[model samples]
Structure formats: structure tokens, C-alpha cells
Target: MAFWRSTSLFSSSTPSTTTINDNTINQETIERLCDRLQLATRIEDRRDALRDLKGYSKKCKLEVGTKSMILLADILQGDRTDLDLIQLALETLSNIMTYEVDNNDEQPNLPQDITIQFTELFIKNKEHVHAALDLIEETDFNIRRTSIKFLTILLTNCTKTLQDIILESGPMGVSKLVDLLQDEREVIRNDALLLLQILTRSNANIQKIVAFENGFERLFEILISEGGSDGGVIVEDCLSVLLNLLKNNPSNQSYFRESSFIRRLVDCFALNSIGEKHWLKQKETNINLFLQVIRILVSPTNSNQNIVACQRSISQCGKKKIES
Candidate 1:
């Protein structure tokens, strides 16, 4: 969702305060956009309506809350091939349904209760969530990226409900998200990584599904490619997803150990050009997460064999570090 930045996706249709008098969106304008969306038969007209709706949504999200979700979902479900229309609709929905609500008494865009109600409506109707999920499969970059962003927001709103929906989407369900991890596009890969971290936390069934998709192999591969601790923020995100997959999930821990991915995990600690004194914030964070992953594998509660295997891996990593 990249904070629902309209400029990034639609530079031409960026929201302008001048379009809405006094930086306020009137109800009349809102209804007109809805009418254009419903009655317009031409593809261009519908696109224009959605674009305008997206602009208005940015102007005042509370005014657009829940009121336009049905129409937006309809566009998502009814028109899959129209990339422009879908991207606009998704961006509009993202703006309208953000966790960032303004509680200011003078100009409250969305109240807490309204936010809950909006989330509940989307959750109660599984179709809306599924529609967004299907869009992730689209080849169009903006459509796929926007849909992923929208789902991230939804998941953040109500984790349990969203997690259940994604899990019920069958084996291919989690696979779609997992596939994004390998996408050549770094931003898309990073977005997918963040979503996976949230989605897999404390959810053993989903974790198993992810692991089956060769999750550990792909993630570690990315870690090594990114230069491990020396890599940018993407490295930390990758580690976070790995942590979520293994944390408190004994089945996943055993699977990780059995898969013989420990060697790959140790490789992350290999020394890089940046020494400890020159380690930046992200590098420090990444090293801490790597340490956390090591701690999890070697914890006492784990079977002695697993702990010993992890210890051996650590000793090997240390020896490599010393010999270098």
C-alpha cells in the first residue's frame, strides 16, 4: 500500500486540494462519483469515476468509509482484466480503509467505531477478501502491488479473520503470497515478506503450508544474496518472516532443522566489508534478528538433538569467523 500514495501509482490523477473546495469533500461529490461508477457503461467513464473516487478518498477518508466498499469490491470482482480500473479501485479502497484514523474533534475523518464496522463488513463477506487475493495473481505490476498493499491493511485490522480467510483459500492460497518472495521486483518481494511475517505469526497451519512451498530455502537464498547482515532493510524483513515461521511453532522448528537449512542460516553471519564499528542501524537490527533465530533453534525446550545440531552449526560459524 506504500501508505496509499496516489502519486506513486497514478501520477496524473494525484489528489488536489483545489478539486475539493476548502480541502473538504462534500456529500454531493461523493454521490456523483458513485452514480458514475454504477451507471457508466463505457470503460473510460468507469475508470474516471474510480480515479475521482480515489482522489476524494484521499481528501477525506471518513466521508468515504464503508460507503464505497461494495462498489469497489464489485469492480474488483466484475472486472479482472482492466488493470487501470482495478488499480484505481484498489488504491481508493486502500485510502478509505487505513488504520490511520484521525480522532481530532475539529475534523474527524474516521471514528474508531466506524473503523471496526468497516473491517467487520469486509470480514463477514468472504468474497471481498477473496477478490483482493485474486488480484495478487495479476501480472500487472500496479494491480498486483496495490492488491497486496490492500490485503496488508486488512490483515493489520483483524489478523485472526484475515488469517482464516487466507488459510481456507486452499493449498494454492498461501502459495500465491509465497511466490512473491521470489519476484525480481524488490519492492514486491519486500511487501510479500512483510505480509508473510504478519500472516504466519502464531498460525501453525499456515506456517506448515508456507514451509511446504520451500519457504526456508527461498528466504535464506534471498538473505545470502542480499549480503546477509550487510544487506538493507529487506534483510531484516526476511529475517522477521523466518522468525515468525519458526517462533513457538515446534513443528516448523523441527522441519527447519530436518531440512538441513541450518548451514544456510549460519552463512548469514559471515563477515562483510562493514566491520562492527561501521555497522549501521539496519545492520545491527539484522544481526540481532539473526541472533534471535539462533537462540530459538538452540532453546532448552527443543529436543536435545535439535539443540546440539544448532550448537554445532554455531561452532562451525564461529570457527569460520575466527579463521577468516
Candidate 2:
């Protein structure tokens, strides 16, 4: 959580010199920790090994660029049997990443060093080389949930480079990332949507690719199923991601104009107003996102059919209004 605040200096034209120091790394201790982490038979033993390493790195304030961080990421890929192992791996990776780029500013793009490090490690692990694809398919819900955090750390901080990784993994990985939007785990779904928001807003390349894969259609499905439910923080995020995907993204405009999103937009208003006024405040925010989406989807130069459709949709949102 703290890592997202620390903006990666690499995102700018003039990247700052990495603050990660490497000279004092006690190579023997790191090797010993890695060996024990891989070989320990007992769950506590394994977790302790990871803990020691976490402390080791933190004390040294290692940059995520080190092979030690890469090793921790490797621990994440296996068909892990121990929940503790998986959790330790997850936390260890989280700690290393935060040490590398922990900022309080809440910036989005990850530094180039951190991005390249994960990419290289993910490439080497090969167990889940396809990334979110295999990880999302894990039978363990906890594992799946942890994957959400790990993947978020990777993509949110680095836009284009990470997008290139998914694109190279082909449509399956990309589709898996989208499928995450509908995950039964609310946090997973929210994280997936957040990642998609980054892709659509900052990475135009992924936006067009997502359009081809029926991403907008799938997102609309999320709206229809989860709209106006006060389940979690996902409602506004879901709506916001769809808005970003369709905003100025001309390729998706056709689908949005013809989409049940129009109807859904109208329904969100219904859900927010008198019919479901109990959720008025939260649902109203969703309605605002919907309205902005409508404005973007219907351009004067694009199609009057869509414009007229949007006009009808806006009117439908007010249909629930009562007369004195």
C-alpha cells in the first residue's frame, strides 16, 4: 500500500539515480537464506528463512534490483502446499518492492529498475511464465488473492513495459487479467479493475488491444451484475475503469453506444435515486462516472445514432422522478 505512494523516478524523462545500495550486501548471508528458504522442510523454518531475508534486505535497504528480490519472487510461482510459505513469499516480495520504491506521494508508474527486475524474474521462473494466466487459475483462493497483490505491484508502477510483457504472453494472459474483474474475491476484482484502469488510461497500446478482446463487453457485464450493490469499494472503481476505457478510445465507442451500459447507466440512476435511495450517495458517484462516460462515448462527429441514444439514456435516469 505504501509502495504505490512512492512514485518511480524512472517515469520521467530524467530518471533519478537509483537509491538502492549494493556494496554492503553480505553475499554469504543472502545465499544461506535463499538456500534455507528453498530447502526447509518445516513451515516455520521456511517462513523464518523468508523473515530473516526480509529483515536482512530491509536493514541493508536493498534495492529491488538485487537478485535477492528476484529469488523471493521465484518463491511465489510454485504449486505451493504450505499457506505460510505462500504468505511469506507474498509478504517478502511486498517488503522488497516497498523498500525499492516506497513513496508517500501515491504515484502510479514503477521505476524502470523495479519493472525490469520483475520482468526478468517472471521470465525465468517459467512455472507461471504466462503470469496472471496460471496464477489466476490456482485452486488456492489465498494464493489467488496474493497473486492479485503481486500482479498489482508489477503493473500499476510500470505502464508500457509491463503491458508489453502481457501482450507478449498473448491474448490468454490479457483475457485472464480482464477475467479478474469478475473474480469472486472482491479485493481481487477491485485490484484487477485498478490495473485495467492504469492500462486504459496510461497505456493506449493495451487499450486498443483490450477493445479487440471484448473487454468493454465484459466490463459492462460487471456493471449489470454488481451495480448499486454496497458490497465493497469496487463499485466506483468498476465504473471508473469502464469510463477510462471508453473515454477518447474511439474504437470502443461503437460497443459503448450499442452496449447495455446505456441501460445500465440509466439503471444506476434508478438504483441511486428513489428506488434505491438508501445507497444514494455512493450510487450517485457511480452515476457521475456514467454520465462522463456517455459524454465521451457520443461525439458529434462520430455518430448521431449514438448521440441520440445517449440522450435517451440520460432521460431514462430521471424517469424515476416523482411529481408533487
Candidate 3:
């Protein structure tokens, strides 16, 4: 099946074309469109220009085509202004983002504005956020993984917006994002971890959002689960985020400390004895992460018995390493 079809970007039936008379277009109009397309800076202006460019493309006007080509060349130049142009370009490109153009297809040369537009939209909009999420659900695992990576870049640029969208999507989006921690794509997993990191920055209400959906247990399972070789980087990131959340919520800390979750986290670094040999190659990284967890667990600000238990776990792990 076609990728776009899976994403539902196009209709099942072929779209009918409405022809425009080329002779009605002139040089001046093309130059004006070019100028409007070039001057687009903010989200609104870029969106307008993209709509106009689509119309121009549909009209088959040579002058409009020339203007679009010039704009696309300027965009692909990798100018410092590329970020500003991403949203506009993305909106226009959404017209084509999921489609595979033929080798000899007469594809319009997208401007810097258009390229930036897509990048920006990917960074800003909640709808685009959902699209990125759905991409993770694709039948092709690579596409699912790539979607997460793309989301990471977007989250880096639009932290507030990313948080807002995640919050708005509520438990469902949170669950999907957490599930991605076990995905085959390392980058996607890393992005999901980063996203959780950002979300934890919100007040207790947002941190509580995780518990509303049983996210804590799901996260623990990922850390302790066996099939996470591709997710080591992400696992480390997830641990960092989890530590932050646990530190912030006294109730959560007390609950996990009593339930064996804390011990299980330390056991995650327990050499080949943990039952997963594939993790050996990543032992050093995992050990460093283990140390970080122990430091957080033993911090003076934490409760007494929990700190002692964490210290014991750390010492045991070190002794086991020495014995080996």
C-alpha cells in the first residue's frame, strides 16, 4: 500500500484537474507572487503564500512556476532564516509530504519559505503533532520510528507547544509516546524520552497526568523489559525523566519505594544476571545511568529508608561487578 494512503493524505479516487488558461497570466503577476512568497515571515503570512502558490501551480502559469522555482532555490540554500520558513513550506509541502513523486515528475521547486513552513508546522501545530504520532503507528516500522525522530526536532524548537499538545492529547497520547520507548527506532525512542522530559517540567498537575494513565508502570516495564537494545539511549533518557517526576512527587516516591519498583530499576544494571545478554554491550552506559539513579535516590532531600535501600542496591551492584 502507498505511504500516503496509509496516512490518508489523499482521496481513494484520482483527483480531477481544473485547467487554467496560461495566456491570461503575465510577468508582473508572477513577480508580485514571488515577492509575497519571499516576504512571508510569520505563520499567517507563510500560510497565505502557500495557498497562493498552490493556486498558481494549479493554474499552470509559467511565470508563477518560475517564481516558485526561485523561492524553492532560496529556501534550499540553507539560509539562517530557514527556521522561520519551515511552517509555510511545510503547509505547502503537506500537499506532497507523504507522496512519492515519479523520477520524471514535474515537481515544483519548493522555496526556503515552504521548507521552513513544514518544519515550523511540525514544530507548532497539534494536528501535525497527531500526524507525527500516527506515523509511529504505520505498518512500516521505519516510518513509525522516523516520525518520532522528526517529533524530537519539533519538540526541541517548540517546547511549550509540544507540552501543550501532549497535555491536550491527554492519557492516550501519553500512552502512545511511552509505548514508543520500546520501538525499533533509536531516534524515535530518544525523542519520546525527550518529550517526557519536557512534560515533567509542568507543575504537579501535569506530573500527575502520568498516573492517571498508569504511565509509571508502563515506563518501569520498558526499563526492565528485555527487547530494548535499540532503546538504550531512550531508556537512559526515560530514567532521567522518571527520576525527576519521582523527586517531585513525595507520594509517588513512597509508593514506588514500597512496591519494589525502585529495586527493580537498580536491578536493571545487574550484569548478565538480569536475564538479557544483549544489554552487555551497553553495560557501561547503563552503569553510568545506574549511578545517576542511585545519586538521585540517595539525595538528602529524599526520605530515610528509601535512601538506605538505594545505597544498598548501589553497593551490591558494585560488589557484583568486582566479583566478576
User: Which candidate wins on TM-score?
Assistant: 1
Candidate 3 segments exceeding 4 Å error: 1-125, 182-191, 194-207, 211-235, 271-285, 303-324
- Model 3: lDDT equals 0.55
Q: Cα lDDT for residue 258, model 2?
A: 62
Write model 3 residue lDDT over 1-324, tens digit each, in one string: 111212222122343442123233434555666677778567566546656665544333233433464354344233324343443343333332222245333233333243233445344445656655555565464455445555555555555667677668766776676676666665666666776776666446556666545656767776766333234555666676776667657666656665666556655654445565554555556566666666666788877876787677656756766777
TM of each candidate vs. truth? 0.85, 0.68, 0.49
Q: By TM-score, rank the candidates, best first.
A: 1, 2, 3
lDDT of 1 by residue, 117-187 (tens): 56667667898888889899887888888889989888888888999998888878899999999888888
Q: Model 1 misses residue 303 by how many Å?
A: 3.2
With candidate 1 superimposed using the best TM-score fit, by how many Å does residue 167's alpha carbon deviate from the native? 0.5
Better of 1 and 2 by lDDT: 1
Compute the lDDT for candidate 1.
0.79
Query: Which residue pairs of candidate 1 clash?
Result: 1-149
lDDT score for residue 261 of model 1:
78
Clashing pairs in 2: 5-103, 5-106, 6-103, 109-157, 110-157
